[model samples]
Target: MEERDKQLLKMIRKQSEEGMSLLIDEYGGAIKAICSNVLRNYDAGIVQDAMQETVIRLWQKLSQRFQVKKNLRAYIYQTARNCALDYLRKYQRHSETDFEGVEDMMQDVSTDVEREFSRKHNERIVHEVIKEMEEPDRTIFILRFFYYETVKVIAETVHLKEDNVESRIRRGKKKLKAELLRRGVLNE
Candidate 1:
């Protein structure tokens, strides 16, 4: 490692207050960043708590059986990450959704199921229309939409220029929209 890290480790080994202060001064921001990234979805207070816990854990480890040959930055990062995870496990609630407690939940679920069924039915109809399209249009539509292929890739696959591939996709979308409308899948 760097000479500074080596000096820091020596100070930590000696258990000096100046060493601890130097460690915090050098790594406080990085330790906080690690904790904040791990606990990004949590409140700022939670991140702060995890950061404090990391410093405590680091001191404990450094004063005891921490491997001398290990990299100090890596050690601090791992400690911060573990401390954040511990905080997450401690604070995160695992309560299940109480369906019975919420009276409208069941009713809302049934309507959601009906809407999903309608969406699937509409998709099947659109797929049928796409299947009826001729040759390269059918292949292009399948590759572009179904397989999520880029225009350049589809052009290479179909032996067509990029412009041709784009034009085909645009036309295919218009056709799909018209067919969807005719089949009462789309209104207005």
Candidate 2:
């Protein structure tokens, strides 16, 4: 760990206000980026909401545990990812989605029962598979493929070099494709 990371841990373990402030100041941008990427389909308001919830959860987790088992940044990244997914699930199940709902997704899709069911099922599997992926790759894959976000936008949002983002996306796509093929979900 870096010197700053050790200090941050000390401050967190001590439960100091300045520590929380510093933590948010340092990681807020990354958390927002993750949430924004994860909730790309949603409006800004939902992204902001997810980001706020992520910070709160992080604060609570640190306050309660006072000990981090792994790298702090990675832990925060995972927290943000899980928090955004939870928000996404909650929004799907409960939020009013007249503007962008299941209907919107299905609007252009075929009406074939077998194809539709298989597609949705495979999509769910893909999501689950993506969730199980490691950091950076998971975020990169979702931002690139699922959201169809531009490489520049993803690089800026995730604070990675544009070429790095592209390479990661390439590898992520290849990995996802292999996994899907292995699972018999991807014919090609």
Candidate 3:
């Protein structure tokens, strides 16, 4: 939370429209990126829906909890991630049967390229593992790894009070690592 962020919070708390606009303008790209990553496998409509939900959540929560010492982009990233995750969970429940053959289908792909091909293939496996993650976790991993958002900002974005964000990130990392290991993409 820099002085500028504190000022923004004050303005937002006062319900200043300009403050809201500034917040959106500054943080929108990061939010969209996280949402896009989390909902990568879903339709574009769902991804857009998730992004809107995340922005709405940020608007609703910002005035009450935003801190000047936090990173705004990270907060937006986490929020986007959580919203994406929630959407995915509901989606999975509704389409569990449709996803039944996913594992078997993944196992059947065979390519003759080794070395560079194997590396690219492993990268694809990593992407698939990320796609399989439940919403917020998938979102969080992308924000933390792909975008390099700070934990403090991530906590604020997700409305988790910092410590929770750290814990969630740790767990998310472990889960991703395990998934990669299971795919034989990571060495023990």
Q: Where does candidate 3 have its weakest 10-residue lDDT segment?
A: 107-116
Off by over 4 Å in 2: 95-188
Candidate 3 lDDT by residue in tens digits, 13-130:
8878998887777677777777777777789899889888987787788867655345655566677889999988878777776867787755654543345588779889988888
| lDDT of each candidate versus the true structure | 0.81, 0.81, 0.76
How many residue pairs clash in all the candidates, one count each? Answer: 0, 0, 7
lDDT by residue (tens digit), candidate 2, 67-103: 6775677778789889899999988876655555676
Q: Which candidate comes out best when scored by TM-score? A: 2
Judged by whole-model lDDT over C-alpha atoms, candidate 2 comes out at 0.81
Q: Using TM-score as the measure, name the better of candidate 1 and candidate 3.
A: 3
Candidate 3 structure, TM-score to reference: 0.53
1-188 in candidate 1: lDDT tens per residue?
66788888778778888889998997787777777867877889989999898888888888775785646766776788899988887776532433454666665988989998997899799889999999899989976664455687678667899999899889989998999899999998
What is candidate 2's TM-score against the reference? 0.55
| Alpha-carbon deviation at 43 in model 2, angstroms | 0.8
TM-score of each: 0.49, 0.55, 0.53
Report per-prediction Cα RMSD to one decimal: 15.0, 7.3, 10.5
Global local distance difference test of model 3: 0.76
